[model samples]
Target: MKAIWGQKMAKVPISWMVLLFMCFWAYMADAEYVKYKDSKQPLNVRIKDLMSQMTLEEKIGQMVQIDRQFASAKVMKKYFIGSIFSGGGSAPAQRASAETWINMVNDFQKGSLSTRLGIPMIYGIDAVHGHNTVYKATIFPHYVGLGATRDPTLVKRIGAATALEVRATGISYVFAPCIAVCRDPRWGRCYESYSEDPKIVQAMTEIISGLQEKKSQLVLNTMWAMVEQPKVSMRTTR
Candidate 1:
């Protein structure tokens, strides 16, 4: 008579099963967070989430921006470039219209979005003198002419106008409000600078504030400033 096989089983520890389930649940929770985070969240929170997903090479790559025409899509995929720039006179082949510029930038942005973190790329241009180099864009008076008018409010209005035209072309960052204390006119970009006096240059911060919307990380650099105001007290010390 063949004896009945009571039970054929492999034993698994209860603690081990519980640990495996916990790990799976935790992984699911993390995946959900990564999928849902986006720009709509608070700026700090969004940035922090993106930071957690980036590698060291990716963070280093973000600091170096390259011209759009020169950027390699393969390298962009590998390096995780955070920003792209179109300095004066750079444009895609076949079409150089404003709409073409927008489309080209959007294409690059799409490639950037394909990376693991899905962060959007920031596009920049020298929108100095009313997006001057691009065809069909407005040509405003250079800083000198505006300064000659000595109307700060008018300057602000011009900045706002420039900002609108720049946005129309689908660009978010502008290398504008060239603030320089020009001691010599021989400099090639002196024309871009507003004044020879430091204070006058300082005043052009208003123009920068106008050109860029509030609370943006879009400022570019050429100079540094140091403010040292001596405090005077007329009241007698007690």
Candidate 2:
């Protein structure tokens, strides 16, 4: 009698069982939100709730940022990736439009939203000079050229323009307004610095205010301002 009963149960079709399981899971997900998922809760309460629920693997995944070219929705969904970036060489497919970029971001976002905690991913790119990488973006003068102008107001306006162009392409973060003070003209990357004089670099920081119209991001280098001394004394008995 037991053998006959097992045979009958097995004949019920596996697809039907899978369909029922999926439906039950969907219903449960839609039925309620824990405190962390509730928008009305205080931020601290939500943070504590979310942190308590995160597993070690999930926390690690959140701290890692995969390059966009190497990532896809399946990877994001599986790993719960928290961030992605497009480097200087990475670009969308040929002749890709603003819509294409938006769609790409949205697809990755959907993957993240489907995770257990539904954390969104931050997308980034280098925006040193007016969204330089995006197709047809307005390219502004580099820091060296801008420095020569000696007009903080002009640099500020450039920063504002850069922010708008970057946002239009669905990117929020910018690596811009390099604040390094370069004293030597021969340094290969001195162009990134605004000026050799500390005062000039200080004044040009007005760009920060303009970029802050949306949100200005800065790169902080723990470098000290020092002058190289002359190897030989210049004194000859006067």
Candidate 3:
């Protein structure tokens, strides 16, 4: 009877050990080292924490952008690609709907988020005139025409509208509002310029603010200014 009691007492310790192990495991699982994930932290502190954790490969990956045609979850996961862009005429399928666009972006995002650090990839589009890549999206006049109005407020409204449409397609970046002050008409991209007048070009930068200030303030809006120097070669185009 003493031997049996001894065996039971030994089993009690084993159960206690298992319980203690489970508690330890839970605490470990809940532990978070990602101070960057906390928005309340100062921006500089978050940037420092994230930069400290990144490997050289990860830093390089963050700087590299690839076209959407070459992008997939597997490719993104493997290369840790930072940004994905839809170059001219690139779409998931011909005349893809908003839902299709969202799914495609989300798929790429999943690959990005699955990485060790879970840095999400930024998706960009050459949405200069509007969300022109999307089917049925509004196509606004180029900057040259908008500049003719000499009304920055009107330009701002158009930009806000363009931002709304761009967001509808699940895009996070715009390569737009071609802020170039075209000095020469011969430049191939002269139409992209708001005006030859530097003042008008400066006034039209209101578009940038419009793109960033969404109605709900929900989007992580980013814009790429495609500034142009006078292209001497572009003189041959028109």
Candidate 4:
């Protein structure tokens, strides 16, 4: 009778342990189903919920755009960088492959998403003419040449092709379609100008529509003179 009683006492604790574990698991499952993670919610509602949960440092991090040379997984996580960019001639190597570019961008993305908020970082590059930074990408004619052709359809096709090449390397934004009216041939970047005439510039804006399919924003370079000095502002506001 003593031996049977001891065995029953041991079984009581085991049953209690199992029940406690199940209760704990139920709580965790409920916690994981947060409103911010629900896709059915409206975008604004989702954004509001996310913003409400983020710390001030995290909100400030989203405003900064870091260059690839200075970017790292640790830095991205620590600062919560919102975007990464590759300037002209800033490829991983002299002729980095498309796969290499994609992998590099993905690594940065992983770092960004590893933070507490898990927000994805936007990747950008100077893919003005094809994926100019990557090897084996199609090298299209310059905007000046394309403008001279006077074919909006061909220009639009080029823009679409450029967007594809940029995406192949995992970049989501492009610095392209430089809409500058070059009044002087001596300017260093005069070749980037589509034409001296405003009409040509207006017509070539169709490229904006082609590039918009990928949710990519066009980097417009507009030079306006001030009374005292020439201020060169690289505006991506549009």
Among these predictions, the greatest TM-score belongs to: 3
Residues 1-238, model 2: lDDT tens digits? 9999999999999999999999999999887758887889999999999999999989999999888898788999999898888767577776567778888888888889999888888887777667777787788888888888999999888878877776776766555556667877786778777789877877777776666574544221112243211321222110
lDDT of 3: 0.78
lDDT of 4 by residue, 1-238 (tens): 9999999887787779889999999999998876787899998889999999999899999999888999988889999999887878888877888888988898898999899978989887887767787888899888788889888888878888777778778877776657777778998777777788877766775666666565543433333211111222445422
Tens digits of lDDT, candidate 1, 65-129: 88888775565666788888777777675437878777777777777778877666788887777
lDDT of 4: 0.76
Cα RMSDs, all models: 9.2, 12.1, 6.2, 5.9
Q: Give the poorly placed runs of model 3, Cα more than 4 Å off.
A: 1-26, 216-238
Q: Which stretches of candidate 4 lie over 4 Å from their true place?
A: 1-26, 184-187, 214-238
Question: Candidate 3 lDDT, tens digit per residue, 1-238?
Answer: 9999999888787778999999999888779547998889999999899999999999999989999999999999988899998977899999999999999999999999999999999998888777888888899888788889898898877778888888888887766656666787787888878888777777777776676674612232222233333311111111
Top lDDT hit: 3
Q: In model 3, state the lDDT of residue 141.
A: 88
Q: In model 1, what is the error at residue 151, expressed in angstroms?
A: 1.6
Off by over 4 Å in 1: 1-30, 35-49, 72-75, 93-95, 213-238
**lDDT of each prediction vs. the true structure?**
0.66, 0.74, 0.78, 0.76
Please provide TM-scores, in order, for all candidate models, with all chains considered together. Answer: 0.71, 0.73, 0.80, 0.77
Query: How many Å off is the CA of 23 in candidate 4?
Result: 7.6
